[model samples]
Target: MIDQLFLNNFKAFRSASIRLAPVTLLTGLNSSGKSTVLQSLALLRQSYDSGILMSIDGDTDSYGGFLLDGDLVELGTGQDLLHEDFASNPPGADPRISIAFTTTDKQQYGWTAQYVPEQDVLPLNLAIGPSDWRDAALFSRRFQYLQADRITPATTYPRSHHQAIGRGFLGARGEHAVNFLRHHAQDVVPEGHPLRHPEAGGHTLLDQVVAWMQELCPGVNLEASEIPGIDSVRLSFGFGGTAGLDSTRRRRPTNVGFGLTYALPIVVACLTAGPGSLILLENPEAHLHPRGQSRMASLIAAAASAGAQLIVETHSDHVLDGTRLAVKQGRLAAGDTAVHFFRGNGAGVEIITPTVAEDGSLSEWPEGFFDESENTLDQLLG
Candidate 1:
């Protein structure tokens, strides 16, 4: 697991070092640098995926550099990524962006990219690490990043053998989720894992997926199949009327409510969690009702309990409450969870961390941190 992350002249942060845990929650107001944290990690992964982050023995020409635009992220040029108040190298030199992280095993890795205003690929000035940085926790193949703008209900999804089947990627927007589900439907979920649903008919991936989806909308069954002779896969939903919906009919994703389809990738990602897995999620509670939002947090906590490290960016109070509930219920330890609230302070972003006690109580509730309901209620009563 990544124990700490350090960002220098990257987006909203001039320089900031954040301590992380097994399940870290990044909560804050809009554009307060919450997404920046996730983007920094994604930037490294994308660069590595494109062979830019690897150690190059020869002279650094354009052979190895940070790939700004790639399958995982599209950060544009260096100017778009460098901090507004980026630190200059010297009296005459240009600005630079630096990203570094320390793994739980005490391995420190750092990358420095020179800021070229018009260049998309920021040439690396230095790539410093243990040389085996790819073996690090965050750089492992077990990493999955699910962005906020994910696939909505669609007629069909793509079927990529190399991505979905080969790499087990759910896709940045979860475009490969259906194909992944279809291909791994029969794969057995390990026994004694938190992802293994108790009500699942069997320990298969599809069964576990359905059981978890039921938490959002009870009795909801899912199916993933290929469209013959095409490069796409199909997904449909069946309700058992347990949530007061029709049970007899199987419906395409478009026919079901938005929440079920929207939350499918999250369910699959959590169900597939393994030791040392790093799952980054943005707004897992999006399109979900209050109860469903809380349930999503439960699943997140369960995934963490099963040994995957999660870094979630969310604005939902229900997600916070559910995590607290998980702590109270002993599903996740308080020490293993970290919650950081980010906010703009006119100059830059400020992060405040509130400790979670064993009893589900927070050490502090900073203003504008998951207290909007009470803030509005007091005004209305006044």
Candidate 2:
């Protein structure tokens, strides 16, 4: 797992270091540099996947560089990624953007990219830190990144054999989720895994996913299948008799509620998590109700307890409280979780981390850290 992330001259940050844990929650207002954190990691992942962050035979520009556009993240030119107010460099040295990280194994890895305003590739002047660092969990094949604006209720989703089957990617927008599920539905979840729901019908991935989805809407069941001759897959939902529906009839995603489809990618990602998995989620609580949001937090906590590192960005207070409850109930240790509050003005961004106690209470609560409810209540009661 990554123990620390360092950003220098990167977007919106002149220099910043963030400590990560098994479960890290990034909460704050919109555009307060929260997405920037996830973007940085995605950028590196994209660059590496494109062979732009690897070592070169002789010339640094021959092979390794930062790919500004790639499968995982599409950052514009260097000017778009470089910090507006970059810190000063030594005399006669050109400005550059750098991202560095230290793993729990005490391995330090970093990369530096030259800035070119209109160029899509920011040529790197240095190779990845160590040869062995390439095997770190962050670079493993089990990594998944789900952006905030994900696929909503849809009739049919695309099916790509290479991506959904070979790579097991859920797509940045989770467009391949249906295809992935169709391909891996029967795969058995590991025993003693937190993702293995007690009420699940079996140890298969689909069974666990259905068990978790039932939390958002009881008696709900899902199905993923392929179109007869098209390069697409279909997703449908069914409600049992308890939900006033015929259990035999299946409804298309468009007919079902939005939360189910909206939360499908998150559910699949968490259920697939295992040792050395790095899952990055943006607003997993989106479109979910209060109790459903808290239940999602419990799933996230379970994934972390199962040995995956999850970094989630959320604005829901229930998500925060649910994570705390996980710690109190000993599902996750206080030391294995980190909560950060990002606050930004027009000029700069600030991040405050409140420590979690063994009892699940936070050491500090910054002004805007999920306290809007109390603020409004004070106004009404006064």
Candidate 3:
């Protein structure tokens, strides 16, 4: 579980450090830098996974080549990136990215990566041992970051990996969701019988997911199958109606509503992720109905209860309500969950942590924060 995250001069963040919980909910207005936090984590983990930064050997000059072009404009000099710019008085005037997290074994680790504006490079400053890098290596595999605009309905199959059958690895745009489900179906159910194993908790998890999805569109059933020519297994959803039982049985995954396709990856990822893994989700409530959004919150909370750490960036009250519901239902403790509200001020974006009480009440509610209906009503009544 990532216990903390620090950001400097990364995107909208000039300098910020956020303490993480088992389930961290990031909510704020548009352009408040919520996505930036997640993006930085993704880039850092990706670089580590691809050996992009491992080859740097602590040399700032060698790291300059890897900095994004835009980041160079923010950092005037390459060498200045090494020193923390605490004196910068302007908003969004920080020049470093620092993140601190703890592994499952209670090992504390910190990484500070900054962009050299003059030379366009990013150098990594780590606060943990070389062995910790192995766990960090799994960061790329464990952490899954997604954007809202990128999500789409399953209108077509992805052509990149033809051998893909079921859910694919934390799929891009959730295209590999079905493939991932089919491939990992055994993991979901030990005996390979998903329906019959009522005693198995894992089966119950998947069944609840399928049942919840069915509530959205009745008569839809999900089943896994292996095609003879395909190298991977596939998950197909059967629909029933006047279209005929045969037609419903023959429907491909592409025919389902966008919500299912868009949400399937999130559900599968949470269900499949191992204990101690960090799951960073950007806008998990995107394209989902209020009910579906709430359901997503439940799923995410459930994942955290099962041992995975979840960091979600969302604008939906339903999502917020879902987490609170989890707390109320005893699935999550108040201290185990946190709601961080990001507000842009003269000094970049300020993060406000809202404490969740034992009774599911927030300690503070900021202005223009999840009060959409109130704002609308005031305008109309006026």
Candidate 4:
């Protein structure tokens, strides 16, 4: 697990070092640098995926660099990433953008890239760590980065053998989720595992997925199958009329409410992610009702308890409260959870961390940190 993340001259941060835990929640207002935290990690993963982050003996500068645009992230160019008017830049040295991570094992991996205004590939100036950093969970196969703008209700989703099957990667937007589900449906979520949903019909991956989805919409079950002779996979939903809807019919994702499809990847990712997994989630609460939003947080907590390191970027108070509840219920240790609220300063970002106590209470609730409902209620009462 990543014990800490450090960014220098990265977007919205001139220099910031954030202590992380098994489950780290990044919560704050719009554009307050919450997403930047996730993006920094994604940036490294994408670079590694593109063969830019690896350590090679040759001209490592030409052989390795930060791939700004790739399968996981599209950061554009160096100008887009570097902090605007960053306070410190050496006079002669090519300005560098640095992103570093410290593992729970006390090992730190730091990468410095020479920022070039128009270059999409920021040439690597230095890589600090053991030679084989790929062994880290960040580059390991058990990793998922589900972007905020996930797939909408679609009739079919892509089935990529190399991505969904070979690599076990659910695409950045979770485009490969349906195909992944189809392939891994029968896989068992091991017994005594925190990810094994108790209410699931059986231990199969699909069963756990359905059981978890049911939390969003009760009695809801889903199936994923290959569309005959096509490279795409199909997703369909079945309801048990719990909401007074038709129970007998199987409906495509489009026919159901938007929440189910949009949230599918999150459910699948959390359920299937085993120990040593690194999941970076952006806005898992999107499109979910308040209760569903909270339930997702509990699920996230469970995944973390199962030994997956999760860094979640959310704007939902329900998620925050649900995580607290998880701590109190003993699903997740309070010390293993870290909550950071980001706020915009003049040129960079400010981070305020609130400690979670064992009893589901926070050490401090800063103003504007999950206080919108009360703030609005105050306005209405006035």
Model 3 Cα lDDT, one tens digit per residue, 1-382: 6677766555666567787888998889887877766766665555554455533234444442234323102333445434323434244664445555555456665565554556545666444434445555235456555556544544344432432332135553555555555555555333443122232324543454465455445555566555566455455566652212243455555676566667777776776655666787878887788988887887787678667788889999999998998898887898999799998777667888889988888998898789989899999999
Query: lDDT scores for all predictions?
Result: 0.88, 0.87, 0.62, 0.88
| Candidate with more favorable, higher lDDT: 3 or 4 | 4
Candidate 3 whole-model C-alpha lDDT, 0 to 1: 0.62
For the record, the alpha-carbon RMSD of candidate 1 to the native fold, in angstroms, is 2.4
Tens digit per residue, CA lDDT, model 4, 1-382: 8999999988889899998898999999898999889999999999888776747334454447899898888888899988886645665666689999899888879988888989899988777787667789989999899999999998889989999999999989999999999999989888898988888878788888988899998888888888888899988898773211235788988889789998999999998877799999999999999999999998999999888999999999899999999999999999999999999767568899999999989989988898888999999999
What local lDDT does model 4 show for residue 37? 90
lDDT score, candidate 2, position 193: 81
Q: Looking at model 1, which ten-residue stretch has the lowest summed lDDT?
A: 239-248
lDDT of 1 by residue, 291-326 (tens): 999999999999998899999999999999999999
TM-score of 4: 0.95
Question: For residues 77-154, could you state the per-residue lDDT of candidate 2 as single tens digits?
Answer: 999988998875774588889988888878788888888999989988765566666577767778999998999998
Q: Could you estimate the TM-score for every candidate?
A: 0.95, 0.95, 0.77, 0.95
Displacement of residue 55 (Cα, Å) in model 2 is 1.9
